[model samples]
Target: MSKMDIYRRSQFFISPPAILKVIEVLILVTAMILFLVDNKCSGDLAFVTIFVLPCVVVALATLISYISAVFVLVGRRNPLTTPTWVKGDVWFNIVSLVVMLVGSILTLTNEGCANNSLTVASIALGFISVILFAISGAVTYLVLVRHQQEVKEAQRAQLNTRRVTMSELA
Candidate 1:
């Protein structure tokens, strides 16, 4: 293979998943900041339950996702071919589940703020964050799984071809 092809494959070992996890982290952090500011301005117990708690859950999930992605990337570069990406994907799904569940809880408990429109908008943003994270997680899982499967299949085909050639020569 050309140097460009080798570089591209190495890039695949890390970049995409790391970039995605970073995006998720940024969104969760933004949501948390927005929720915290809203809660402080209102000093409302309901806002704490409806906005703050959910943001905390989402942030925690995002942190988990980041760590898992790093682990996968590092593990892949090392000697172990244990396929740490699979573990990362599983953790991402778990994070998505937690975000969705917390979002649901927030929705059910939300009470209108002094400005009903503002409260609705904030909650809507939180819901969107949850959906985005979940979708990202699913897509990451599918891509990694497909790539790994293709690698395995190709390896098998190569091995089979080698075996057949050797047997014929023998």
Candidate 2:
């Protein structure tokens, strides 16, 4: 890669991978805060409820995704060669999107079950987390899809070139 390309790739603002990493961190922070605050106001229901469990799971997934993003974006590692658990690949984004969607809906619905400042704040933050996760997931998926198309095009071009060269030789 050119120096400019490397610089752009390494930058969080300019790099798609880095942007996804930052979004994962944002989601993690917001979801964790929401979970903690909700736990405080939610009494025993927080620990026992189905909704709260998913919030915790979303927080954990975001945390893992953030760590994986660091390896891929900052360390300049290839996600394709890495283990699925340690890479922010297409599947991870899809799973994160689904989890965030469900978690956000659960959090939003649970808002009606309680009445307090903290609970309301938790729900608001949950929405923010969901938005961030959705953006990250969608962008990641699109980028990967486009990348696959480009790779296929390159392969097809090479194959056609080889066929033409062989026919000419014949």
Candidate 3:
């Protein structure tokens, strides 16, 4: 990343991931409402209900994601955020994103559901969620990758220091 990119990213009130977490929660909630309304009006309630299931599941996932974000954002001593938790977060985002994209595709192609404004809006929100989830996953993955790199650099520096000290002694 460029200096500007890093600068802009770190300048936010909270971290980008935290901001995204809140946005994701809002988007999921909105999508759920839109999906529910669209499904309710689609005639054949039983059949349309199936299409709304993914949104419901995604909403629940958003809740969990939000909690995890909070844990990470909390002041020092927050035990909820370990490397293990970040790995889980990345996996969860990947899975939920796929589920949401599939649901959006299904909703769009379902003949029973009318292609009304609400339906389109719901699908749009789903796409937005997919993008956000993908971004969050990438960011978390990068964090892990960068930490490994930092560790390697530290080890190398320590080794160099030791070599310099030994040569000076000789």
Candidate 4:
């Protein structure tokens, strides 16, 4: 296989969630910068309410989803066959969706606040939450892929050994 093919087959390969996490981090940083730079730019109350508030809500929701996923993954209540990683991922996605819904509602109802700095900080936090959500997703996928690869390797080794023993007997 080519290098790309080998990478594709690897169990420990990077996953979508991992990539998302990186994205989240970047978004959070951007939000922080915006807050720092424009702390006094909140006079346009309508603009802040319509734009910044929604972003803040989104970030918060994403963060919650990320936490939920982590909880599912780390919980030790299930058997080996239960695939905790996958379960965690499912829960994370569900929670994330719910958070997003809540955020949307909040965004719609947002009224501009007097404290521009606080508003900016809230938006920054929202970005941070999204980053966490992405990371959770990536980690879950990586775990699952690794487990599957290990199983396949074990099975292949067993079959090879069997073939050698049969040949020796003959």
RMSD, every candidate, angstroms: 4.5, 5.1, 4.1, 8.1
Instruction: Write down the lDDT of every candidate, Cα atoms only.
Output: 0.57, 0.56, 0.69, 0.51
TM-score of each: 0.67, 0.59, 0.76, 0.47
Q: Highest lDDT among the candidates is held by which one? A: 3
Residue-pair clashes per prediction, in order, are 0, 0, 0, 5
Question: lDDT value for candidate 3?
Answer: 0.69
Q: Tens digits of per-residue lDDT for model 2 on 1-170?
A: 44235233344344555465566556556655655654543455543244456556766765666566566656665442234422345566556656656665665566443455655565566566556666665665655555557668989999999999999999
- TM-score of structure candidate 2: 0.59
RMSD (CA, angstroms), candidate 1: 4.5
Candidate 3: stretches off by over 4 Å? 1-13, 38-41, 69-81
Residue clash pairs of candidate 4: 17-137, 17-138, 18-138, 24-131, 59-126
Q: Provide the global lDDT of candidate 2 against the true structure.
A: 0.56
**Model 1 over residues 93-143: C-alpha lDDT tens digits?**
566657555764555364444344444455556666666666666666665
> Model 2 misses residue 78 by how many Å?
2.7
lDDT tens digits, residue span 106-146, model 4: 53344443246555454546535644665565566555676
Ranking by lDDT: 3, 1, 2, 4
Clashing pairs in 1: none
After superposing candidate 1 on the true structure, give the runs of residues whose Cα lies further than 4 Å from its correct spot. Answer: 1-16, 39-43, 76-85, 98-101, 104-109
